[model samples]
Target: MTPPPYMGRTFPETTSHYLTTGTDVLDSAGVEAALKAVTSKGYGPVAGAQLVLLCNEREADLISTWRRGLPSREATADEVAADANAVGPTAKYDFVLSASAPAYLTDETIVGRQAPSDFNGLPVFDSYGEAFVIKSELIPAGYVIAAATGGPNSEGNPIAIRQHPNAAYQGFREIPGAEQYPLINSYCQRSFGVGARHRGAAAVLQVTEDATYTAPTFAV
Candidate 1:
């Protein structure tokens, strides 16, 4: 019988090299305007009723960005009313504010009602619009995100996770070892990808006045 091909192969032999690359699509003019509007003015005291204005601005900008992808048309009376009084299930956008933002919106004038012990969001409203401001510790200071929510067939969802079609390749899978002894060896592998879905469905505000934007650093 012929000897195995790798009978005397070196342990550290080089196999094949693989390279991966990715790219990001640039923001549209409308999205760029939305980002600029929020960041143009630096952070200041958003205490008391000012929180309502802030949430309105964020939500309006997000809506403007989403509308850029569609044809221009006059908003219906119902749509205008919905935008002006959005609350609870009618809210079209979610304001994910920085963790520290809750402190500024705690005033009785802004809160308007006694919140339930389990409630974690503060609903803010202006004459033009409204949204629920949710605080997230993961969000860096001076940053907020207004993301569209609740649409037919995941229409407004901004993020997506894709995986291999085969169930065995979707998540972690155990690789059988060459050895047949009782003490078996193995390895695990998985394949998946994650990325932004609806580009205009979300807007990120840096909350600064600097000409250029700076990404925040997180401490592990």
Candidate 2:
């Protein structure tokens, strides 16, 4: 069988907060609980450590300067700021996938929907970008990925960045509910399509940080 289509789009997800808001500091156990709650939501299979590295020890201005010079970090302050500078800008990539297959379907929503499933058949995709995130429900090290759709909402579709048919995807320029639909800007060749019309996968999941890092792609 061609496998019945899946429904809903909330991959299993886990988050951590580097923040502390209590008389007592957040310990390992308490932090773990917060993480579990987010993960349990089926947002994603995001795994990473969240540490309170005590940046309070440093001065405010120096914090930025020092952190900027640090060795290996995911995103730069400028990079994150720039991406959000202009709204409604699309991005480029090697490929994108949606991980919320049979992963997350809350009671009311799942009532008439198909169970979520993954290419691995295990359900849930874990491939998030740790770089672009400035803040997350995940702890300090908490970062993960969930395959998902990207494109105009009206089309009920996602655009694949790189690979096609299965890996690469293109857009039709008209996204239903978008404030403005962009004319077909061929960022790249279409290696993939959706439904019988395009003869491609009905869905394409995107890994926030999987592809080219030059341009950052944020997830839902």
Candidate 3:
């Protein structure tokens, strides 16, 4: 079957950042946890590593806070003083994918209700040009490779199941048990292998409810 409407939109730009606390105010352990998760699988030479961070609202807030608080490594003495009073830290990362994205959904939400009018009040979505962090839980259980072009071999290809063109997928049909409701079934029938040639290219670091960021306590 054809992909859903929400799949049409392009993903946010691929960006990278070296997550650092720079001070003990934020948990260094948590920062390390996030860092290890992203680089755990090592980096990809061709793809340059696309690390997608999946976080909830609270986690996003914490990350954004840490990002804004960290001191800039490249700032000269004069430049640093010019903006010493800035409240929020300068963001050098890609945009965080909010709940409005198409992939952010539970299985129950998709099958039960029709597409909603607004996804978390976001009627439109564009490439997040600031931070690489994405705030959606619907991403697949592994590293998510962002789509890209111009690379040797399959350096930037999408992660998909490859199948024959004609017999790639099955058409939509009705189910026997759910005759009353308007449920269509267009599942995949053709056999295909996982289309990820460069697994290292795509990576994700997911957080659970119990996850914590342990910052160091310093003595005065």
Candidate 4:
């Protein structure tokens, strides 16, 4: 048999990259503006509520950054509301305010534990998973639930009249104290609605929060 490529023989290792273009061409500032606005609007409703920072850095750090990022320009607020409108209630939020790698979660109002110096970066957890991390009462919750056949990847038709009760319950498993774990490849939590799964809601908050200077980042 042929030796594996590396130190002996070699075989081609390749992957394809994709191109994604928005409906309109936006400048760097425009892009930044949109991001700022949408995130700002999101906070408006949950201004004082505890938030989680689920990226690489501390959750508290992420929360601080989000609040500060909001008001630097007045347009940010509107931009946020606009994003909400565009996404509708059922989809995910547009950005990630937490640190990268291992998909860390930060409480919007609290500071997290110190990170180790020997931190291994989490690369696989990117946007697609990021898009799925949502807030509120998610149908099936935000997380993927085990299929009703009690099997993996067995998500059956949600609309069938005889759907399994667990189809929805098994779907959204919460990451308890999610703000502390290193960034996991996950979806963005944007609201309090439980979404399609349940006949009720989880904890849906309004779409706005108040802002003030948070520690770490200087006022923009």
My TM-score estimates for the predictions, one after another, are: 0.39, 0.17, 0.32, 0.17
Identify the leading candidate in terms of TM-score.
Answer: 1
Model 1, 105-155: lDDT tens per residue? 432233233222222244332121233344445565555554544433354
Per-residue CA lDDT of model 3 for 1-220, tens digit only, reads: 1111222432233433323333323332333444443343343223364333344444444554333235323343554588875332344432233434556543432222232223234232222222144445443322222322223344453355455566424333333344564345423333556675534333333322223322333355
Which pairs clash (backbone N, Cα, C closer than 3 Å) in model 3? 27-215, 68-89, 93-130, 93-131, 94-130, 94-131, 94-132, 95-131, 97-134
Tell me the whole-model lDDT of each prediction, alpha carbons only. 0.38, 0.25, 0.36, 0.25
Q: Model 2: per-residue lDDT, tens digit, 14-50?
A: 3222222121222222222333333333322232321
Which stretches of model 2 miss by more than 4 angstroms?
Answer: 1-23, 46-220
Worst 10 residues of 4 by lDDT: 198-207
Q: What is the lDDT for 50 in model 3? A: 32
lDDT of 4 at 147: 13
Question: Scored by Cα lDDT, where does model 1 land?
Answer: 0.38
**The CA-based lDDT of model 3 is what?**
0.36
Model 4: how far is 116 from its true place, Å? 14
- For model 2, the run of ten residues with the poorest summed lDDT: 51-60
Return model 4's CA RMSD, one decimal. 23.2
State which candidate, 3 or 4, has the greater TM-score. Answer: 3
